[model samples]
Target: MKTLVISSSPREDGNSHVLAQSAIDGTVRAGHDAEHVFLGDYVERMLGNCRHCRRSSDGLCSLDDRYETLLLEKMLPADGIVFAMPLYFYGMPARLKTVFDRLFCYTANSAPQQDQVINGIMNKKVGVVISCEESYLGATQGVIAQFQELTRYLNQDLVGVVVGNANSRGEIVNDPTDPVSAAANLGERLYTSRVTDYRLDTARSNKVWDCSPVGCPDR
Candidate 1:
């Protein structure tokens, strides 16, 4: 299966980036194709919204920016999606929000009308990998909530969520099997199309292939 990994941290050597790389490693190791997109690189510049996207029937954004190249054509057709991000000010960054905001064009399967329906963007497996300073229970609550609402509306399957405790740039590199291993585990699960309740700090596994004989392990 093809997996798209959206690395959303501006810092190339930051904790969030470190985990992102690990996730990509896991994805590549799992024998799947991946497109690594650094949000900071292609999304640094955003065009002013003129709402031309709303008029299109195919959910095409006429914003004349990279959204058409990066998100619509690339992200939509991917078999699995992974959002690698870092919590900022207890929420997501403006750039990441920009991407989500622009998705309004594709929020539905058809144009606005009685026959309009959810586009089912969530049918593909969704995974979240977060890096934040605080390791508190809900440090990534905002990200999780966004995914919850997104998956619910899109009818997508949320496969996994991995939160890495990190602060300074490259702080997670020194840390043992945390953001590194945890991130990889999340990526590996993308191939199996299975959601795991595993945590890096507590439960860590090296298996990437489907191991369950009774069917999908957890939904």
Candidate 2:
């Protein structure tokens, strides 16, 4: 199996990057091929230019940027994807969000191979690791909700989510809950487990991952 791990933190060696690296380590230990990409390095290349132009002859984005390469070469061929990032004002960083936004090209009417693009992106195993400063009950709710809807729309299986509370760079290692280990475990599950549907359970009482320090209040 091949897994693509994308870290969206601008700060090198930050808590989110550490967690992402741990996930990659787990994936490799599971005998799966893992590739890591730092989205901060490609922010300038993912300009959401797809919205302005029609799809190319190959039914891919018309932009001459790296986004098309990342999508067609790295992401489409992977069996699973792990998104790692620190919460930015209760949401994902702009660069990471831009990547998702550019995916709209795959669904555009001009794309000749829309079904192929859809199949390439959908029904894959997905994992998420988030680092946030606050451990409040709903601190990560916004981002969580966004991923849930995204996975649902893509018909992807969202296998697991790990949330760590860390304010400073590389502070997640000091977190008593040890979300780093949880993230690694999630990566292992991404390679080992097979689930057709891992959609969000609306009836679930706790929306927050249990690893949070403060923990979610019982509803």
Using lDDT as the measure, which candidate wins? 2
Give the range of the ten consecutive residues with the poorest summed lDDT in model 1. Answer: 111-120
* After superposition, candidate 1 runs with Cα above 4 Å error: 44-60, 108-120, 193-219
Query: lDDT of each model, Cα atoms only?
Result: 0.73, 0.82
Clashing pairs in 2: none
Name the 10 consecutive residues with the lowest summed lDDT in model 2: 202-211
Candidate 2, residue 17: the lDDT equals: 93
Query: Clashes in model 1: which pairs?
Result: 122-156
- How well does each candidate superpose onto the true structure, as a TM-score? 0.76, 0.82
Task: Give candidate 2 regions above 4 Å deviation.
Answer: 45-51, 55-64, 194-219
| Model 1 per-residue lDDT tens digits across residues 1-219 | 888889888887788877778888888888988888888665654534436434455444455557656765677778888888889888888898887775655453443421322343547888888888886777788778888777766667787788888788888766654668978988877756544445568665576555676664633
Candidate 2, lDDT over the whole model: 0.82
Q: What is the lDDT of candidate 1?
A: 0.73
- lDDT over C-alpha atoms for residue 145 of model 2: 86
